[model samples]
Target: MLEGTEAVLAAQLRRLLPHLDERQRRLVMGAAAGVLGRGGIRVVARAAGVVESTVSRGAGELDRGPELSGRVRAVGAGRKRLVEADPGLIPALLALVEPDQRGDPESPLRWTVKSTRNWPPS
Candidate 1:
Protein backbone atom coordinates (compact mmCIF):
# COMPACT_ATOMS: atom_id res chain seq x y z
CA MET A 1 0.00 0.00 0.00
CA LEU A 2 1.06 3.60 -0.65
CA GLU A 3 1.18 6.34 1.95
CA GLY A 4 0.29 10.03 1.81
CA THR A 5 2.08 11.72 -1.08
CA GLU A 6 2.94 8.40 -2.65
CA ALA A 7 -0.75 7.55 -2.80
CA VAL A 8 -1.50 10.90 -4.38
CA LEU A 9 1.27 10.46 -6.92
CA ALA A 10 0.10 6.97 -7.76
CA ALA A 11 -3.44 8.21 -8.27
CA GLN A 12 -2.21 10.94 -10.56
CA LEU A 13 -0.12 8.46 -12.52
CA ARG A 14 -3.14 6.22 -12.96
CA ARG A 15 -5.19 9.10 -14.27
CA LEU A 16 -2.48 10.20 -16.70
CA LEU A 17 -1.39 6.79 -17.98
CA PRO A 18 -4.11 6.40 -20.63
CA HIS A 19 -3.29 9.79 -22.16
CA LEU A 20 0.46 9.07 -22.34
CA ASP A 21 2.47 6.89 -24.71
CA GLU A 22 4.03 3.75 -23.23
CA ARG A 23 7.52 5.20 -22.85
CA GLN A 24 6.24 8.40 -21.34
CA ARG A 25 4.23 6.47 -18.80
CA ARG A 26 7.21 4.34 -17.93
CA LEU A 27 9.49 7.33 -17.61
CA VAL A 28 7.07 9.20 -15.40
CA MET A 29 6.58 6.17 -13.19
CA GLY A 30 10.33 5.59 -13.02
CA ALA A 31 11.03 9.19 -12.12
CA ALA A 32 8.41 9.23 -9.43
CA ALA A 33 9.73 5.97 -8.05
CA GLY A 34 13.22 7.39 -8.09
CA VAL A 35 12.03 10.26 -5.97
CA LEU A 36 10.79 7.72 -3.46
CA GLY A 37 14.34 6.28 -3.12
CA ARG A 38 14.93 2.74 -1.78
CA GLY A 39 12.18 0.13 -2.37
CA GLY A 40 10.73 2.51 -4.94
CA ILE A 41 10.78 -0.08 -7.70
CA ARG A 42 8.41 -2.40 -5.90
CA VAL A 43 6.20 0.48 -4.80
CA VAL A 44 5.85 1.96 -8.23
CA ALA A 45 5.51 -1.40 -9.95
CA ARG A 46 2.64 -2.40 -7.70
CA ALA A 47 0.92 0.97 -7.99
CA ALA A 48 1.29 1.15 -11.77
CA GLY A 49 0.25 -2.45 -12.33
CA VAL A 50 3.51 -3.07 -14.21
CA VAL A 51 6.23 -5.60 -13.54
CA GLU A 52 9.22 -4.50 -11.45
CA SER A 53 11.58 -5.14 -14.35
CA THR A 54 9.69 -2.68 -16.52
CA VAL A 55 10.06 0.06 -13.94
CA SER A 56 13.72 -0.81 -13.52
CA ARG A 57 14.23 -0.53 -17.27
CA GLY A 58 12.51 2.82 -17.24
CA ALA A 59 14.78 3.99 -14.47
CA GLY A 60 17.76 2.83 -16.47
CA GLU A 61 16.49 4.70 -19.50
CA LEU A 62 16.06 7.80 -17.39
CA ASP A 63 19.61 7.55 -16.11
CA ARG A 64 20.93 6.96 -19.62
CA GLY A 65 19.46 10.29 -20.80
CA PRO A 66 18.00 9.62 -24.29
CA GLU A 67 21.15 8.07 -25.77
CA LEU A 68 18.94 6.20 -28.27
CA SER A 69 18.19 9.16 -30.55
CA GLY A 70 15.89 10.75 -27.93
CA ARG A 71 13.10 8.41 -28.93
CA VAL A 72 10.50 7.70 -26.28
CA ARG A 73 9.26 4.40 -27.64
CA ALA A 74 11.54 2.35 -29.82
CA VAL A 75 10.90 2.12 -33.57
CA GLY A 76 7.78 0.14 -34.63
CA ALA A 77 6.55 -0.29 -31.06
CA GLY A 78 2.92 0.73 -31.30
CA ARG A 79 -0.15 -0.72 -32.98
CA LYS A 80 -0.49 -0.02 -36.70
CA ARG A 81 -3.00 2.55 -37.89
CA LEU A 82 -6.55 1.35 -38.66
CA VAL A 83 -6.21 2.00 -42.40
CA GLU A 84 -3.00 0.00 -42.55
CA ALA A 85 -4.49 -2.85 -40.56
CA ASP A 86 -7.69 -3.02 -42.64
CA PRO A 87 -7.53 -1.69 -46.18
CA GLY A 88 -11.25 -2.22 -46.79
CA LEU A 89 -12.51 -0.56 -43.62
CA ILE A 90 -12.84 2.93 -45.08
CA PRO A 91 -14.75 1.74 -48.15
CA ALA A 92 -17.08 -0.37 -46.04
CA LEU A 93 -17.79 2.48 -43.66
CA LEU A 94 -18.32 4.86 -46.54
CA ALA A 95 -20.81 2.53 -48.16
CA LEU A 96 -22.70 2.17 -44.91
CA VAL A 97 -22.92 5.86 -44.01
CA GLU A 98 -22.84 7.60 -47.37
CA PRO A 99 -25.84 9.96 -47.71
CA ASP A 100 -26.31 9.91 -51.49
CA GLN A 101 -24.85 9.11 -54.92
CA ARG A 102 -22.16 11.64 -54.22
CA GLY A 103 -21.24 9.18 -51.45
CA ASP A 104 -19.99 11.73 -48.95
CA PRO A 105 -18.22 14.00 -51.39
CA GLU A 106 -17.27 16.26 -48.56
CA SER A 107 -17.12 13.83 -45.67
CA PRO A 108 -18.54 10.50 -44.58
CA LEU A 109 -20.67 10.51 -41.44
CA ARG A 110 -20.66 14.31 -41.66
CA TRP A 111 -24.48 14.62 -41.60
CA THR A 112 -25.19 11.19 -40.17
CA VAL A 113 -25.75 10.76 -36.45
CA LYS A 114 -23.62 7.87 -35.21
CA SER A 115 -24.04 6.16 -31.89
CA THR A 116 -22.46 3.17 -30.25
CA ARG A 117 -25.82 1.37 -30.18
CA ASN A 118 -25.99 1.48 -34.00
CA TRP A 119 -22.47 0.15 -34.55
CA PRO A 120 -22.10 -3.57 -35.19
CA PRO A 121 -19.63 -5.46 -33.04
CA SER A 122 -16.62 -6.48 -35.07
Candidate 2:
Protein backbone atom coordinates (compact mmCIF):
# COMPACT_ATOMS: atom_id res chain seq x y z
CA MET A 1 0.00 0.00 0.00
CA LEU A 2 1.07 3.61 -0.58
CA GLU A 3 2.50 5.61 2.39
CA GLY A 4 -0.35 8.09 1.90
CA THR A 5 -2.85 5.22 2.07
CA GLU A 6 -1.34 4.10 5.41
CA ALA A 7 -2.02 7.55 6.89
CA VAL A 8 -5.57 7.50 5.48
CA LEU A 9 -6.28 4.13 7.08
CA ALA A 10 -4.93 5.43 10.41
CA ALA A 11 -7.25 8.43 10.24
CA GLN A 12 -10.19 6.26 9.31
CA LEU A 13 -9.47 3.86 12.17
CA ARG A 14 -9.28 6.77 14.63
CA ARG A 15 -12.62 8.13 13.48
CA LEU A 16 -14.44 4.79 13.31
CA LEU A 17 -13.09 2.80 16.27
CA PRO A 18 -14.71 4.94 18.99
CA HIS A 19 -18.16 4.43 17.45
CA LEU A 20 -17.78 0.64 17.30
CA ASP A 21 -17.89 -2.08 19.94
CA GLU A 22 -14.85 -4.29 20.60
CA ARG A 23 -15.94 -7.03 18.21
CA GLN A 24 -16.94 -4.54 15.50
CA ARG A 25 -13.55 -2.82 15.66
CA ARG A 26 -11.79 -6.14 15.18
CA LEU A 27 -14.07 -7.13 12.31
CA VAL A 28 -13.57 -3.80 10.54
CA MET A 29 -9.79 -3.99 10.85
CA GLY A 30 -9.84 -7.61 9.74
CA ALA A 31 -11.95 -6.72 6.70
CA ALA A 32 -9.58 -3.91 5.76
CA ALA A 33 -6.59 -6.25 6.02
CA GLY A 34 -8.38 -8.92 4.00
CA VAL A 35 -9.13 -6.42 1.22
CA LEU A 36 -5.49 -5.25 1.25
CA GLY A 37 -4.32 -8.88 0.79
CA ARG A 38 -0.60 -9.63 1.54
CA GLY A 39 1.15 -7.65 4.35
CA GLY A 40 -2.16 -6.00 5.30
CA ILE A 41 -2.25 -7.44 8.81
CA ARG A 42 0.89 -5.58 9.91
CA VAL A 43 -0.24 -2.40 8.16
CA VAL A 44 -3.68 -2.52 9.80
CA ALA A 45 -2.19 -3.38 13.16
CA ARG A 46 0.17 -0.38 13.01
CA ALA A 47 -2.65 1.91 11.82
CA ALA A 48 -5.00 0.70 14.56
CA GLY A 49 -2.36 0.87 17.32
CA VAL A 50 -3.05 -2.76 18.29
CA VAL A 51 -0.90 -5.89 18.26
CA GLU A 52 -0.70 -7.91 15.04
CA SER A 53 -2.16 -10.85 16.93
CA THR A 54 -5.40 -8.90 17.53
CA VAL A 55 -5.75 -8.24 13.80
CA SER A 56 -4.88 -11.88 13.07
CA ARG A 57 -7.58 -13.01 15.51
CA GLY A 58 -10.06 -10.73 13.79
CA ALA A 59 -9.15 -12.17 10.39
CA GLY A 60 -9.64 -15.66 11.86
CA GLU A 61 -13.07 -14.61 13.16
CA LEU A 62 -14.04 -13.41 9.69
CA ASP A 63 -13.00 -16.80 8.29
CA ARG A 64 -15.04 -18.49 11.04
CA GLY A 65 -18.28 -16.90 9.74
CA PRO A 66 -21.20 -15.41 11.74
CA GLU A 67 -21.28 -17.88 14.62
CA LEU A 68 -19.95 -15.14 16.95
CA SER A 69 -22.36 -12.46 15.73
CA GLY A 70 -23.77 -9.96 18.29
CA ARG A 71 -21.30 -11.14 20.93
CA VAL A 72 -17.85 -9.80 21.80
CA ARG A 73 -16.72 -13.23 23.03
CA ALA A 74 -17.93 -16.81 23.09
CA VAL A 75 -20.71 -17.67 25.56
CA GLY A 76 -19.60 -18.43 29.13
CA ALA A 77 -16.19 -16.72 28.64
CA GLY A 78 -16.16 -14.99 32.05
CA ARG A 79 -15.99 -16.04 35.66
CA LYS A 80 -19.09 -17.52 37.36
CA ARG A 81 -20.72 -15.61 40.24
CA LEU A 82 -20.07 -16.54 43.86
CA VAL A 83 -23.81 -17.06 44.43
CA GLU A 84 -23.81 -19.54 41.55
CA ALA A 85 -21.24 -21.69 43.37
CA ASP A 86 -22.80 -21.21 46.80
CA PRO A 87 -26.59 -21.37 47.00
CA GLY A 88 -26.65 -20.20 50.66
CA LEU A 89 -24.48 -17.10 50.04
CA ILE A 90 -27.36 -14.76 49.22
CA PRO A 91 -29.32 -15.47 52.40
CA ALA A 92 -26.13 -15.18 54.41
CA LEU A 93 -25.23 -11.88 52.75
CA LEU A 94 -28.79 -10.57 53.17
CA ALA A 95 -28.81 -11.52 56.85
CA LEU A 96 -25.49 -9.71 57.27
CA VAL A 97 -26.76 -6.60 55.45
CA GLU A 98 -29.95 -6.40 57.56
CA PRO A 99 -28.87 -7.21 61.08
CA ASP A 100 -32.35 -6.55 62.50
CA GLN A 101 -34.10 -8.82 59.94
CA ARG A 102 -34.36 -12.23 61.54
CA GLY A 103 -33.07 -15.09 59.39
CA ASP A 104 -33.98 -18.76 59.41
CA PRO A 105 -32.51 -20.36 62.53
CA GLU A 106 -31.78 -23.59 60.68
CA SER A 107 -29.45 -21.70 58.30
CA PRO A 108 -25.77 -22.28 59.13
CA LEU A 109 -25.18 -18.53 58.74
CA ARG A 110 -27.75 -17.61 61.40
CA TRP A 111 -25.12 -17.71 64.11
CA THR A 112 -22.68 -15.54 62.12
CA VAL A 113 -21.98 -12.32 63.98
CA LYS A 114 -21.63 -8.89 62.44
CA SER A 115 -18.30 -8.40 60.71
CA THR A 116 -16.59 -5.59 58.81
CA ARG A 117 -16.52 -7.71 55.67
CA ASN A 118 -19.93 -7.96 53.96
CA TRP A 119 -21.31 -8.47 50.47
CA PRO A 120 -24.16 -6.79 48.59
CA PRO A 121 -27.59 -7.97 49.75
CA SER A 122 -29.11 -7.85 46.33
Candidate 3:
Protein backbone atom coordinates (compact mmCIF):
# COMPACT_ATOMS: atom_id res chain seq x y z
CA MET A 1 0.00 0.00 0.00
CA LEU A 2 1.11 3.54 -0.64
CA GLU A 3 2.02 5.91 2.22
CA GLY A 4 0.14 9.13 2.85
CA THR A 5 2.40 11.24 0.67
CA GLU A 6 2.08 8.73 -2.15
CA ALA A 7 -1.71 8.66 -1.84
CA VAL A 8 -1.73 12.45 -2.01
CA LEU A 9 0.56 12.26 -5.02
CA ALA A 10 -1.72 9.78 -6.78
CA ALA A 11 -4.70 11.99 -6.05
CA GLN A 12 -2.89 15.00 -7.41
CA LEU A 13 -2.10 13.03 -10.56
CA ARG A 14 -5.72 12.03 -11.05
CA ARG A 15 -6.67 15.68 -10.68
CA LEU A 16 -4.33 16.63 -13.51
CA LEU A 17 -6.07 14.41 -16.08
CA PRO A 18 -8.45 17.13 -17.21
CA HIS A 19 -5.49 19.20 -18.36
CA LEU A 20 -3.90 16.47 -20.47
CA ASP A 21 -4.43 15.14 -23.96
CA GLU A 22 -6.09 11.74 -24.22
CA ARG A 23 -2.78 9.97 -24.78
CA GLN A 24 -1.09 11.76 -21.90
CA ARG A 25 -4.08 11.18 -19.62
CA ARG A 26 -3.94 7.46 -20.32
CA LEU A 27 -0.24 7.59 -19.53
CA VAL A 28 -0.90 9.40 -16.23
CA MET A 29 -3.42 6.82 -15.05
CA GLY A 30 -0.96 4.06 -15.97
CA ALA A 31 1.82 5.71 -14.01
CA ALA A 32 -0.48 6.24 -11.02
CA ALA A 33 -0.66 2.50 -10.36
CA GLY A 34 3.01 2.46 -9.51
CA VAL A 35 2.51 5.54 -7.39
CA LEU A 36 -0.31 3.73 -5.55
CA GLY A 37 1.92 0.65 -5.06
CA ARG A 38 0.26 -1.40 -7.82
CA GLY A 39 3.51 -1.92 -9.80
CA GLY A 40 6.22 -0.39 -11.93
CA ILE A 41 6.06 1.20 -15.38
CA ARG A 42 6.25 -2.11 -17.29
CA VAL A 43 3.21 -3.50 -15.54
CA VAL A 44 1.29 -0.23 -15.58
CA ALA A 45 1.84 0.34 -19.30
CA ARG A 46 0.88 -3.24 -20.08
CA ALA A 47 -2.36 -2.86 -18.12
CA ALA A 48 -3.16 0.47 -19.78
CA GLY A 49 -2.39 -0.83 -23.28
CA VAL A 50 0.08 1.96 -23.88
CA VAL A 51 3.80 2.17 -24.67
CA GLU A 52 6.29 2.02 -21.80
CA SER A 53 7.73 5.37 -22.82
CA THR A 54 4.35 6.99 -22.39
CA VAL A 55 4.02 5.72 -18.83
CA SER A 56 7.64 6.51 -18.13
CA ARG A 57 7.06 10.09 -19.25
CA GLY A 58 3.98 10.37 -17.08
CA ALA A 59 5.83 8.97 -14.06
CA GLY A 60 8.62 11.45 -14.70
CA GLU A 61 6.17 14.33 -14.75
CA LEU A 62 4.47 13.13 -11.59
CA ASP A 63 7.85 13.01 -9.93
CA ARG A 64 8.21 16.69 -10.66
CA GLY A 65 4.88 17.14 -8.83
CA PRO A 66 3.42 20.57 -8.15
CA GLU A 67 6.77 22.19 -8.81
CA LEU A 68 5.95 22.16 -12.51
CA SER A 69 2.33 23.28 -12.06
CA GLY A 70 2.37 25.99 -14.70
CA ARG A 71 5.14 24.57 -16.88
CA VAL A 72 4.71 22.56 -20.05
CA ARG A 73 5.80 18.94 -19.95
CA ALA A 74 9.03 18.30 -21.79
CA VAL A 75 9.61 15.46 -24.27
CA GLY A 76 12.70 13.30 -23.91
CA ALA A 77 14.11 10.09 -22.55
CA GLY A 78 14.34 10.33 -18.74
CA ARG A 79 17.59 9.63 -16.92
CA LYS A 80 17.78 6.74 -14.47
CA ARG A 81 19.50 7.53 -11.19
CA LEU A 82 21.70 5.13 -9.23
CA VAL A 83 19.72 5.79 -6.06
CA GLU A 84 16.21 4.72 -5.07
CA ALA A 85 13.35 7.01 -6.15
CA ASP A 86 12.39 8.34 -2.71
CA PRO A 87 13.00 12.09 -2.53
CA GLY A 88 13.13 12.41 1.27
CA LEU A 89 16.23 10.25 1.73
CA ILE A 90 19.21 12.47 0.98
CA PRO A 91 19.42 14.32 4.31
CA ALA A 92 18.67 11.15 6.24
CA LEU A 93 21.45 9.33 4.37
CA LEU A 94 23.92 12.17 4.72
CA ALA A 95 23.17 12.46 8.43
CA LEU A 96 23.89 8.76 8.86
CA VAL A 97 27.35 8.76 7.36
CA GLU A 98 30.61 10.65 7.79
CA PRO A 99 32.61 11.67 4.71
CA ASP A 100 35.44 9.16 5.09
CA GLN A 101 33.85 6.24 6.92
CA ARG A 102 30.74 5.83 4.82
CA GLY A 103 31.86 2.33 3.94
CA ASP A 104 32.27 1.43 7.62
CA PRO A 105 29.64 -0.28 9.78
CA GLU A 106 27.80 2.99 10.36
CA SER A 107 25.19 2.19 7.75
CA PRO A 108 22.16 0.52 9.33
CA LEU A 109 22.43 -2.22 6.69
CA ARG A 110 26.09 -2.69 7.71
CA TRP A 111 27.17 -3.16 4.08
CA THR A 112 30.95 -3.26 3.77
CA VAL A 113 34.01 -3.77 1.60
CA LYS A 114 34.30 -7.24 3.20
CA SER A 115 30.91 -7.97 1.74
CA THR A 116 31.99 -7.04 -1.77
CA ARG A 117 30.48 -9.33 -4.42
CA ASN A 118 33.91 -10.49 -5.56
CA TRP A 119 34.90 -11.62 -2.01
CA PRO A 120 35.20 -15.41 -1.74
CA PRO A 121 32.33 -17.07 0.13
CA SER A 122 33.13 -18.71 3.45
- Candidate-wise lDDT, in order: 0.79, 0.84, 0.58
Better of 1 and 2 by TM-score: 2
Which pairs of residues clash in candidate 3, taking residues 3 or more apart in a chain or in different chains?
none
Candidate achieving the largest lDDT: 2
Candidate 2, which segments miss by more than 4 Å at Cα?
76-122
Tens-place lDDT digits, model 3, residues 43-63: 555545557787777676666
Q: Name every residue pair that clashes in candidate 2.
A: none
1 versus 3: better TM-score goes to = 1
lDDT of 1 by residue, 1-122 (tens): 34576577669878989998778877888897898899888888887888998889889889988665767767897789999999999999868766534435665435555556966646
Candidate 3: where is the Cα deviation over 4 Å? 1-27, 36-39, 67-122
Descending-lDDT candidate ranking: 2, 1, 3
Q: Candidate 2's residue-wise lDDT over 34-110, tens digit each? A: 99899999999999999999899889989999853567877897779998989999888776657654568677564
Which candidate number maximizes TM-score?
A: 2
lDDT at residue 61 of model 3 (Cα atoms): 62
lDDT of 3: 0.58
What are the RMSD figures for all models against the true structure? 5.9, 6.8, 16.4
lDDT of 1: 0.79
